[model samples]
Target: MRLLRDLTNITFLELDVTSTKSIASAYRTVENQTGGKLHYLVNNSGAGFVMPLLDSDIEMGQHLFDVNVWGVVRVTQTFAPLLVRAKGTIVNNISTASCMGLPYQGMYCGSKAATRLMSETLALEMKPLGVAVVIVITGNIRTRYQGGSYFSSIAERIGVYARGEQGHPQMEANLYATKVVGDVLGGAEGTIWRGAQSTIVKFALAMIPTWLMNQLAVKGTGLDVMEI
Candidate 1:
């Protein structure tokens, strides 16, 4: 609220990415406000779950994908015309988890990975049309969305196996401490993965191999003890 009041140029529009009707309405508003041309379209809606894939409900995963993956596709498709009119850019906020899958965060990672791929494809398709598509793959930057059931549910499940300091050494430290700026475009081409420790972590994950990462994730989150 304070930011809204302080920012003279910023306008807040109520948008529910999961709802086509809401997106359509917001698009109309933006079109009217900008006279049918927009400079940048940013899709940042996301949801997450933090339980083992087996324990996590399929519906929960669906919901996450709805907001994180499909929502970006929806918003981008809806606004692509206006972006083309202005030769603007489309930016999707993805996550590092998309690149490096982590235990207890597979659903979120999967959804983000989907969006990341979608953005890459969109970038290629939009290039000829002069509409730049950019992806911002973020690392842990605290936000309210990080709270809620996933946190409690994950903590409880981990507590069951993480008792008495017997949990993996990784559990002793914050699971996601490396904050990163991630992908950002400079001249509307190529991807830039920035932010703190992003280079080191990216190199390590790439060199370590997928199987090793999975094993590390299982132990790190104490998911190795989960039965069935």
Candidate 2:
């Protein structure tokens, strides 16, 4: 991640996505640091929780929504005026799971789905004011947040164990993360290209009929369509 940062123009800022005050303060700091002119704002911060829906803790669901859905709403609302002032763009980094609907990651996916809709609605509302709202539906990306050990710990605690060829979700997540990290470290251009592809796919999917989209999502995630 550091290497990628060093190779790109991206700047990292520390902020608690779940906290409105923290987000506001961070925005203020960034504005002051950059002299109050923000051209492009990307709401990419998120966290995930994976567990069977019945066994999942309600508090965990709240936390996931806090960071994944409400956080984007809060950050975008805070920075929207600035973006509108600059006629800038706001990109919300959503997930393929938002539409695909994976098992165990229901909370995370639900939050992302909510955010995706919010972004679309905001895009329409902001268009009249010349503010561009873009939702980037991203696929799996390698990062510390996708660490295998972290997911394994959660799986173990939640009693969602898998044996033999049953398919360990944690292992799959780890592999996906590793591939994403490799892509990021390989070059900024490739990562951007992959992101573009994801956004295009998301846009195309959004244009499909709801029932068809639901069917495709069931096929994509290997989940029973009736279950969702």
Candidate 3:
């Protein structure tokens, strides 16, 4: 609203990325407003979840993929026609987690990884149509998203396993891994250095051997004990 106060050409449309009907409506609005010419379309809607793969039910897993992966597909498909008409570009906001899998957040990582691959394929497939696809792989940044959704529930479960003093080695490993990742992310609300630190980590992860990267992920995210 504040930005609209100073800008007259900008328009905002209420969009639900997960719903095709909603996406179609948004596309129509944009088409009508801009006369079917779109210079750039960015897919940035995503969801985050924090829980062990074992604890996450199918529904929960599906929800994560729906929003993070399928939503992008829906939006892109809906707007591709307009983009083709304008010979525009599509930018996808991906994550570094997509590059390397992380424990506890496996579902979220997997969804993002799938989206990255999809975007890559789209880049090649749409090139002939003069539609350029660009993907921005972001590392950890300061945001309040860590506290929303299932964060508290997942944290509580992990906490129970931590304080119970039970002889469960897996839970113990999970507790340790969770703490390590939490520290790396600078806990819930990240610090100013988070963006830079995460970018460095991504660079490091990319330069290392795949096996070494997996080993680090296993130790850091407690995926060593997780059964595939």
Q: Which of 1 and 3 is the better model by lDDT?
A: 1
Which candidate leads the pack in TM-score? Answer: 1
What is residue 92's positional error in candidate 2, in angstroms?
A: 0.6
Q: Using TM-score, rank the candidates from best to worst.
A: 1, 3, 2
User: Of the pair 2 and 3, which is ahead by lDDT?
Assistant: 3
Model 1 root-mean-square deviation:
6.1
The 10-residue segment with the lowest total lDDT in model 1:
171-180
Model 3: pairs clashing at backbone N, Cα or C within 3 Å: none
lDDT (Cα, tens digit) per residue for candidate 2, span 90-190: 76777777775655677877998898888878888988887766665566443455433333434443333122222322324456445444543443211
lDDT of 2: 0.65
What lDDT tens digits, residue by residue, belong to model 1 across residues 67-124?
9999998899899889999998887777777887776677888998888898899999
Q: List model 3 lDDT by residue over 5-28, tens digit each.
A: 667777878899888889989999
TM-score of every candidate:
0.79, 0.65, 0.72
Q: Pick the candidate with the highest lDDT.
A: 1
Tell me which residue pairs clash in candidate 2.
Answer: 142-177, 142-180, 142-181
Between candidates 2 and 3, which one is better according to TM-score?
Answer: 3
